[model samples]
Target: MLVIQIYADNPLRNFNYLIACPSSREALVVDPLDVTRCLAAAKQHGLKITKILNTHEHWDHIDGNEEMRRHTGARLYAHNGAMGVIDHVDVGLYAGDTIAVGQSIKLKVLDTPGHTRSHVCLLANSAVPGLFCGDTLFNAGAGNCHNGGNVDDLYDTFSQQLAKLPDNTKIYPGHDYILTNLKFTLDREPGNRAAEDMLNMLLDHDPHNAYITTMAEERRINSFFRLDSPVIIDKLKSEDPDFSAAPSPRDVFTALRARRNTW
Candidate 1:
């Protein structure tokens, strides 16, 4: 069996996940911001840290890499494209690379760029189907463009790569921004009953508990999934001057993300 544990950290409230394969007693840490917490958690769980899987090269996601790798002798796995940023990635993953964690446990790397040119998402069905989405995806929404983000690229990644995953897949994003992102989703899709109800529920409680969102839920409510929907495209055009003309899905997504980044 495979188990996942989450640790939230620092100013960004980044969410780090530790995945373990019980039979082999081996584990992988994903996007840890602090090595102290990751090491502590590993000790508590009685699992040997074997690998460090990076979803992207963002400082927050990779800051603990050097420390954790040195302390635990864990191999660092990252996109082959992030050569300079992430030093010594033992397993350089690509769009279709498959990584074996233990017996009956494997992660399928999907090169879901647009959040960054080298960004990728780790998909697996070890226990529950899961997606360790770094900056590429978030709770109720997706990542904002920071370094190499292109709206068009994000659209293709979301619609083609991520959308292809099974609806039951559990989406564990790099950060916990559900409440805030849910508000944005509500604004973008006011008529969505699920979005409205979820927003109401979030407004009444703390956002920390709303960290995890399912792929099934995202498909029903996330604006990015509604690529051909006139309401979504119209909203994107209204907010993004760059998308005033005939724009592709990527152009529209970029504009929306640009506006959100400034918010």
Candidate 2:
């Protein structure tokens, strides 16, 4: 069985995860935001953390990398581009790298660079794929373009890379703001029945930890994932009349992030 844990932290309200394979008693910590909490969880679960996998070098995502590595003596892994930011990385993973987690779990790395040039999302459960999409994708949301982020890059990463994942793949994002993100989606496309329905569900239920969404759900409700929808396209055209005839999904997503940044 695959065991996953999500932890929310300060500043960005980020959600970090730990995925373990029960068969081997080995684990991999993904974008751990808090060192103490991550270590505590490992101990509580009797997990031997053998790897510290980084999605990117953002302060929040990697702040605990150094500490966690020291605690577990696990090998530090990061995309090759993160050499400068990550002090002592042992594994330099790239787009096609496949990492073993315990005896049963294998993560196929997809070099998804939009939030940061080095950002990578781990595609796990290849036999039954799921994504531990750090900041690359989220539940009705995606990462911001603050660090090395670019609108064009975000577009390619989401549309060409992540959006193509099988609809059933469970999306364990870097955070839980589906409700807030859905609200923004509604604002952008008021007549969207799908977004409205999702909004209602989120309203009715508290969207507790159990509410993490699937790829199919995000495809319908996430504005970024619905760039082809007339509602979103119209809004994009209104904002920048000279924009390309077919603006990428990242274009719409970047605009949304900018709007939210000022909110």
Candidate 3:
């Protein structure tokens, strides 16, 4: 069986994941922002940290790589494009590369840029599939295109890459911005009951608790992924008069992202 543990860093709201193969007791740490906390979690699970995988080179994501590597002697992996940005990367990976945790578990890397040009997501291809999407994808929103990130790239990442994942794949984002992102979705798509229902359900849970949402759930609630929805298209057209030229999904997506930036 595949074991996944989520550790949240207080104050920052960053989520770090520890994934392991129970039979082999071998594990990989994903975006460990807090080395001490991650080490403690690994110790609690009695799993050996064989590898450290980074989703992006952002300071918050790769900050603990050096410390974690020093303590665990694990090799660090990051996208090849993040070389200078992530100084401690021992092995630079590409889009189609796969990393083995043990004899049974494997993590497939997807080059999901736009949050940052070098960003990647790790998907666990097992009975219980999970995606460790960094800032590239949030629960109801997508990452901003600031700091060398492009909105068009983010659109493709969502509509092309991430959209291809199985609907049942559990989404484990880098941050817990569900409530806030849902509020933004509600603002844009007020008539969407899926977003409203999800917002209410999430409101009842402890805000600090780690959330694991499925792609099916995201497809319904996430405004960024619903570019073809009539409500979203109407809203975009209403907001921008020039958007009457039979807006493509990309056009609607770009407008949503632009509005989100100021929201």
> How does each model score on TM-score?
0.89, 0.90, 0.95
Tens-digit lDDT track of model 3 for 9-49: 47768888888888888889999898888888889889899
For model 1 the TM-score comes to: 0.89
Clashes of each: 3, 0, 0
Whole-model Cα lDDT of every candidate shown, in order: 0.78, 0.80, 0.85
Top candidate (lDDT): 3
Q: What is the C-alpha lDDT profile of model 1 across 1-263, one tens digit per residue?
A: 45554656466877777888778878889987778877888888888889999998988888888889889999999998997788778878888888877666788899987888888898986556998888888877888766877767787888788888888888888877777887777677668787788777667655345445678888776766655667777777776666656767666666667667876
Count clashing residue pairs in model 2.
0
Q: On residues 1-263, what C-alpha lDDT tens digit does candidate 2 reach at each position? A: 46566565465767767778888889999987787877888888888889988898888888887788778888988999997878888989888899998998888899988889998889886655789888888788777887787767877888788878898888887877777888888877878888798788778654335476788888888877877777777876787878667766556666776776664
For model 2, where is the 10-residue window of minimal lDDT? 204-213
What lDDT score is found at residue 200 in candidate 1? 77
